[model samples]
Structures are given as C-alpha cells and as structure tokens.
Target: MPHKDTQGRRDSTGGVGGPRPQEGSPRGGLTLSKPSQRRTGRGRAEEELTRLVSEARLLEGLSDSLRDMVMRAQAYLAELRTAGSTLENLAGQEGVEVLVPIGAGSLVKASIKDADKVIVSLGADVAVEVDVEKAKEIIGNRLAEAQKALQDYVARLREVERALSAYRERIRSLLEERGLAGGPEERSK
Candidate 1:
C-alpha cells in the first residue's frame, strides 16, 4: 500500500517495503495537485497583464509629450520662416522705421541703421551680426533642424503607440482566456 498525505496526495516516498500507487490510480489522487497549481499560474498571469498595462500607459504619456514637442518645434519653424521673410523685405528698403516689440505688448519705434546687417541668435544668449544673405541661411538651417526634430518625435510617438496597442491586445487575450473579459466590474468579484 502507498502512503497518502493529509489532502490525499501520495507521499513522495512510499511506505518501506510497500507497493507504490499506480501513476493513474482510480482514486484520481494525481488530479488533486492541479487546483493549487492552476491558482498560482492564474496569479502570475494576472500580475504580468497588470504590469504590461501599466507600461503601456507610461508609453502613452511619453507619446503625448513627444507630440507636444513636435508641435512646439513646428511653431518655432514657422516663426523662423516669418523672420526670414521680414528680413528679406527690409534688405531692399532704406531708412525704414519699424516698431520693435519690447515685451508685454510694448513697442518702440526704431530706424534701420544698416539694412544689410541682421543680428542672429546663436543660442546660449549669444547673438551675432550677419548680412541679409547669411541671416537667411542661418534661418534656413534652423528650419531644417526643427523639421527633422519634428519628424523624429512623430516617429517615436508612432512606435510608442504600436507598443501600447500590442500590450492592450495581450491584456485582452489573457483576460479572455481566464474568463475575466467581462470588464472590471466582473473582475472585482
């Protein structure tokens, strides 16, 4: 005879000099181990699904930030283009009086001293005086860089969206497999 544990599972070591339980005993003792093992497997699956959903949410937030950055970059490019056009128009004018903004909706009347020279910011609070053609070139380069940055951010956002979609699909499939796909109301119970 074989020894049985408290829940009727066969002991790892049979009683000394006794016969072992048949691997497929009619008492169905082997099946008793399945419920606890299934519970463990289900718990692990739920944890993994939760983790994936959290990661997807974070990626969505990152995607939104990237989209905002792209929009800002595009707006800056438009401003640069406008500046370049204004400089071109001023290049051919002589003794042109312009209203320069001094922030806070204030403007100061100024006369162009040198129509050929324009001051271009080189970032880091640094500005340099350049001729009209050089200023236009700098603006063009800045526009190109801004466009490239916008494209890169858009691509990254698409990649994040793809990852989010994939995670959502996995979560859905796992929930359906576990018969928990009726939504949060059902899962809570």
Candidate 2:
C-alpha cells in the first residue's frame, strides 16, 4: 500500500508536494524534472547529427575509391590494346632473334619457334596457349566485363553521394531549428 498525503493523494516517497525542490538548491528551489527532460532531448539530437555526419564522410570516401578503381580499369584496357598490337607484329616474324627477359634486366637471345601461339592467363595461376586472334578476343571480353563493373560501381557511388547530401541537408535544418547552426563548438553548449 502506498502512503497518502494530507490532501488524500498517493505519494511514492511519502512526501507532500506540488513540485519537489532538489536538494542543495537555493530557497524557492527549481524542479529537476523539466530541465533533465530538455537535456535528454538535446543529447539525442546531437547524437543523431553526429551519426549523419559520419555516414556522409564514409560515403564520400567510397565515392573516391570507386573513381580510382575506374581509372585503373581504363589503364588496364589501354595496356591490353598495346599488348594485342605487339602480338600481331610478332606473328609476322618467324625466325627473327628476340631478346627475352629472364629477370632483373637480364635478357637472352631467342628465336621464335611459333610466334602465332600466344600464352593467355585465365587467372588463378592458370595459363593456356592460344592463337593471336583468340588472345585478342579474350582480352576484349575481359575489357567489356571490366567496363560493365566500373559502370555499376560509378552508379552506386553516385547514389551514396546523393544520399549523403540529403542527410547533410537534413542535419543542417535540424541544427537551424535548434538554434545551434552556427558551428560544432557553438552546438556543444
């Protein structure tokens, strides 16, 4: 059974009160409840803003990484074209002596036994011998696949950037509404 005050109202702490004064406060002390509630609300808003800012930064970083990947893919495609041309030129020379690099700037003079056959890497440490035209076709197919993957990455990066921008705008509006839009230092109080 709960205790009752003189006015017949049940009191949890057995104290008669309208609004209880906090201990150690001045005479005619202020209530603790309203101020604590305000602080809780403000703290939650600040946390949300911080989270939004972090997400935006992550998205921006991802966009930059995707751009670098696209550039590297394009460079690889150019190298493949150069390699294909070199292979085509080699096909015309049958008994010509060539300097084949063994390792570390060392070269050995070698005669072309069958210049028409080219070794193509199929990934995973596996390579197969194929004709020049077939090697070109394989390189072309790989380039097309890389281009498609690059396009997909670019599209995802754009989406993340747009989402980040929207989140920033929302955070700005929230801060402005709370009268803390001046800067982070101003909002700390």
CA RMSD of each candidate after superposition? 7.9, 8.8
By lDDT, the best candidate is 1
| Weakest lDDT window of 10 consecutive positions for candidate 1 | 12-21
Question: What are the runs in model 1 whose C-alpha is more than 4 Å off?
Answer: 1-32, 178-189
Instruction: Give the top-scoring candidate (TM-score).
Output: 1
Clashes of each: 0, 0
Q: For residues 52-148, could you state the per-residue lDDT of candidate 2 as single tens digits? A: 8888788878878978887887888787777767776886788999888899989999998888888999999999999989988888888788778
Error of 2 at 148 (Å): 0.7
Which residue pairs of candidate 1 clash? Answer: none
Over 7-85, each residue of candidate 1 has an lDDT whose tens digit, in order, gives 5655534653333345558865444356766886888798998898888889889988988998898899899889978
Give me the displacement of residue 9 in model 2, in angstroms: 22
